[model samples]
Target: LVQTWKDDSSIFAHDGRLNTPYSDHLLGSKYCIHAKGFEVNTARVGDSLYYGCVPVILADQYDLPFMDILNWRAFSVVVTASDIPNLKKILQEISPQEYSVLQANVLKVRRHFQWH
Candidate 1:
């Protein structure tokens, strides 16, 4: 059920090959790991704030619903795969200072929005 362009798909399975140079070509990426299965969950859970890379969370159901368990916006943005184009614009225009403000707002929401 892996979704990918036909040409891109074959090259991956040609010899149990994995990983892509495409992620490497991104504007400021230092490293990128595009993976499948349970490994995806492990990767996301393991990432830290110092990672710096803006993780484009690809999972929908488990992810979208799971955010209710904890306040995670301290370090991530959850966007659907199709909305990546608009996300790219958001990433470009959102300055570091503004991003910090957004993080601070998230903390505020976490502290105040809790149910008593």
Candidate 2:
């Protein structure tokens, strides 16, 4: 799915028929992949929380926001660069019971990601 999204230039292109809004995608997705960009922090994390989507962080040596205060592991899944190939396996290993707990924690921490 990720590969398809990357290949379809039309998805991001200005004149595509399926140029759906980003927020619309987030709302429909269960897990939102937060890849590392030029900056250490990105708005993708906040966007994931805003829509109640679990964040799958695919960054190496990246410091998450509010790390000192928030226990990120409780809400998000952290995958190292080398483990990219095993992402599907890792996510599949998470039982439905555990997934539910993680999702609930995501909601609990949603307020912290909000700005006044």
Candidate 3:
């Protein structure tokens, strides 16, 4: 099941029971989708890395954090807005081994996203 979080609508607001803790959700999920927010970057990407959930970035021409120092592809998947329709097929094409490597890289880079 694909789980998403959006707070724009009050009807979808969590009353608490149906809500899995954010950290828990990340820990349990294999992939986390991080779309651009009002800003070019959002905390969702960092949160995904912190919990070792491979991020699927759905932003076009948006600069990611630590581009010079870190190879984002080692830990995450990036897709253009135009490719949104193919997202499922693209992700599904990733072999299990590749996914494992991505997840491992996420763990390696988790500290970089943390506040000292």
Each prediction's RMSD over C-alphas, in Å, is 9.2, 4.4, 5.6
7 in model 3: Cα distance from truth in Å?
18
* TM-score per candidate: 0.41, 0.81, 0.79
Query: What TM-score quantifies how close candidate 3 is to the native fold?
Result: 0.79
Q: How accurate locally is residue 28 in candidate 2, as Cα lDDT from 0 to 100?
A: 78
**Which residues of candidate 2, in runs, are more than 4 Å off?**
4-18
Prediction 2 TM-score vs. true: 0.81
Give the Cα lDDT of each candidate: 0.42, 0.79, 0.77
Ranking by TM-score: 2, 3, 1
Best of the two (1, 3) by TM-score? 3
lDDT of 1 by residue, 4-116 (tens): 32354222212244376533333234222233344345343333122344334544433432456755555456655566445445465767776776545443443333334
For model 1 the local lDDT of residue 71 reads: 53
- What is the alpha-carbon lDDT of model 3 when measured against the actual structure? 0.77
Candidate 3 runs further than 4 Å off: 1-18
Ranking by lDDT: 2, 3, 1
Q: At residue 10, what lDDT does model 2 achieve? A: 31
Number of clashing pairs, model 3?
Answer: 0
